[model samples]
Target: MRIMTYNVHVWYDNDGQFKLQEMIDLIKLLKPDLLCLQEITKHGLTEFVKQTGFTKVFKYHSVAILTNIENVEELSPPSNTRNYYPRFATVKVPLGDGKEFFLTCVHLDYKVETNRMKEIKQIKKHLSCLNADAAQVWAGDFNALTLEDYSDVVLNEITSVRRKNNWEMPKNDVSTTMKADGFECSWALVDRPPPVSTCRFDTHIDYIYINQDFRKIFEVTKVEHHGSTASDHSPVIADFKLIQTDDTEEESGDQ
Candidate 1:
C-alpha cells in the first residue's frame, strides 16, 4: 500500500500564486493508493478529480481524499465538536478480502495548539463511534509537535514522540491518539529515516499512522518528505508491503 499525506499550502505557491498543475504532476508521479490532502480549495478539488480520474473522492470541508481504489465511502466527523470548520474527514476503505479499515485524514487548527488539541480529541471521539476494531489509519498534517521539538517553530513539541530513557505514556494528543488501543507511528516502523522537513518552515509536521493490527501484516518499506515548488507544505510518501501469506511475505520488499 502506498499512502501519502500533504498540506498543499492552500493550493498556492510561495508568491501567492496558484500552481495547481505542479501539485497535480507531483501527485501523479507518486501515484499513491491513498492520498490525504489538506488546505485544498474548491478549485483544487475539481482539478484533482478531473485529472487523476480517481474512482472515489471524499471531501470534508477543505481536506480531501483521492484514491483509485474501490469500495471507499465517505463518513462524517464528530457533530459535537463540528461547531467550526471541519479539520478532518472520515473514510472507510475495503481491503478486498472481506476486510475494511477506517481512514481519518486530519489537518488540525494550524494557528493554535490548544485548538489543535481540542480538534484531535474530537477526531478520536468520532473514531471511537466507528468500527475501530478493524484496521485504522490516521494520516495528515498533525501540526502537533513532539516534545523533542524545542525549537520555537512549534509549541515546545506538545506531545511525546518517543521515550528516550524509559517507556512512558505520553500525554500529548499525538501519543493519546496512537495509544488509543492499537496504533503506532508509521515512520517508526521502517528502518529507513523519514524526511527531515516536510515544508518550507522546516517542520516535520505531516505524518501517517496505522494501527497495531497491521503491524504483523504490514511493513513500511520507504518514507520520504520532499519540498515542492507547487505548495508550501512538502509532500510525504510512505510505501508499504501488506503480507497476507507466509510465502509471499518472504518476497523482497521495496527499498
Candidate 2:
C-alpha cells in the first residue's frame, strides 16, 4: 500500500506564492492509493477532487482525504472532544480477501504544547475504544518535535524561544505519550535518514504511525519526505508490503 500525508499550507508556498496546480501535479506524479491532506480550503478541495480523479473524498473542516480505492468506509472521531472535526478524520480501507484496517488522519494543534497535549489525550481515548488486535494507522502534521530529531543544544535553543514567549518548555511528551501507548513511528522504524525538515521550520514534525497489529501483517518498505515547492510542508510517504497472513480472529470494540 502506498499512503501519503501532506499539509498544503493553505494552497500556498512558503514564499507566499499560490501554486495549487503545482501541488496537484506533485500528487499526480506520486498517485498514492491513500492520501490525507491538511490546511486545505473548500475551493482547493474541490479542485483537487476534480483534477486528481480520486473516486472518494472525505473532508471535515480543512483536512481532506482522497483515494481511488473502492469500498472505503468513512469513520468518525470522538465528538466528545471540543472542535474535533477539523483536527481528526478517519476511514476504513478494505485490504481485500476480507481483510481491512482503520486509518485516522490528524492535524494536531500548531501552537502551545498544552493544547497539543490535550488533543493527544483525546486521541488516546479514542484509540483505546478500538479492538486491541485491529490494524490501525494515524498520520499527519503533528506540529510538535520528536526527541530523536534534535541534539541537546538544538533542543535547548528551541526551548529558549518558547521561554521568551512565556510558554512552558517542551518536554516532548506527545511523542513519548504515543510511544507509551504502543504506536510506532514509521519514520523511526525505517533505516533511512529523514529530510532536514518536513516543514519550513527546519524540523521534522509530520509523522506516520502504525499499531502493533499492523506491524504483524506488513513490513514498512520506505518512508520519505516527498519534496515539493508547492507547500511549506512536504508530503510524507510510506510504502508497505504484506509479509504474513492476517489473523482472522473476531474481536468486538468501538469504531
Candidate 3:
C-alpha cells in the first residue's frame, strides 16, 4: 500500500501561488491508496474529492483523509476539549483480503504545548479503545520533533520536562505509526542519510506510524520528502507491500 502525508499549506505552493488543481494533479499522479492531509480548508477538501474521485473525511482545522478504496469507517473524535478545533480523524479502510485497518490522520496543535499534550492523551485514550486484534496506523503532522519518552503519556500519564538523548524522533521515524508498547520507528530501523528538510519554510513536522504486526508484513519501501511549492511543509510518501497473511492465522495478530 502506498500512503502519503502532506501539509498542503492550504493548497498554496512555495511559489506563493494558490492552485488547488495543481495539488489535485499531484495526488492523482501518485494515486496513493491513503492520503493524510494537513491544513486543508473545507473548500480545498471538497475540490480534491471532486477532482480525484476519492472519498474524503474532513476535520475542522488542519486534518483530512482521502482514499480511493471503499468501506471507509469514521472513528469518534477525541474527547479532550482542548482541541475543539478539529485536528484528527480515524478512518477504517478495507485491505482487500477480508481484513480492515484503521488509519488515523492527525495534526496536533503547534502553538500550545499544554494543548498538544492534551491532544496526545486524547489520542492514546482513543487508541486504547480500538479492536486491538486488528492492524492499525496513525499518521500525520504531530508537531512533535523530539523523541522523549511517550510511555508516560501512552502508559502512565506523567507529563512535563524534556528528556536528554531523546532527539526529536525524526519526522520519518514518527511518521510510520508503530505500536505504543513494542513497535519501533521505521526510519530508525533502516539506515539512511539525513532527510531533506520537509519544512523548508518553517519546521519539519508530519509523520506516519504502523504497529509492529503490520511492519512485519509490509516494508517501508520509501520515505521521500517531496519538495513543496504547494505548502509550507513538504509531503512524505511511504510505499509498502501488503504482505499476504494466511487468513487462518491468529485473528488477534496486530492492532
Best by TM-score: 2
| Local distance difference test scores for all models | 0.73, 0.82, 0.66
lDDT of 3 by residue, 1-255 (tens): 888888888888767889788888888888888899888888878888888888556464567787767678777665546525557888877765566778888788765445666676667677788766667676787775533323335312212222233323223233333334445444444543246356752334566667765675677777666754667787777778766556524443643
Q: Which stretches of candidate 1 lie above 4 Å from their native place?
A: 80-82, 149-181, 191-194, 246-255
- Which pairs, if any, clash in model 2? none
Instruction: Judge candidate 1 against the unseen true structure and give its global Cα lDDT, from 0 to 1.
Output: 0.73
- lDDT per residue (tens digit) for residues 185-233 in model 1: 6765664364556666555677787887666566778877765768887
Per-residue CA lDDT of candidate 2, range 113-228, in tens?
77888888777676676677888888999887887778789888877887897765666888887788788889889854657479876777898888888887778999998778
* Per-model TM against the reference: 0.81, 0.88, 0.75
lDDT order of candidates, top first: 2, 1, 3
Candidate 2 residue runs with Cα over 4 Å from true position = 77-86, 160-168, 246-255
Per-residue error for 140 in candidate 3, Å, reads: 1.0
Better of 1 and 3 by lDDT: 1
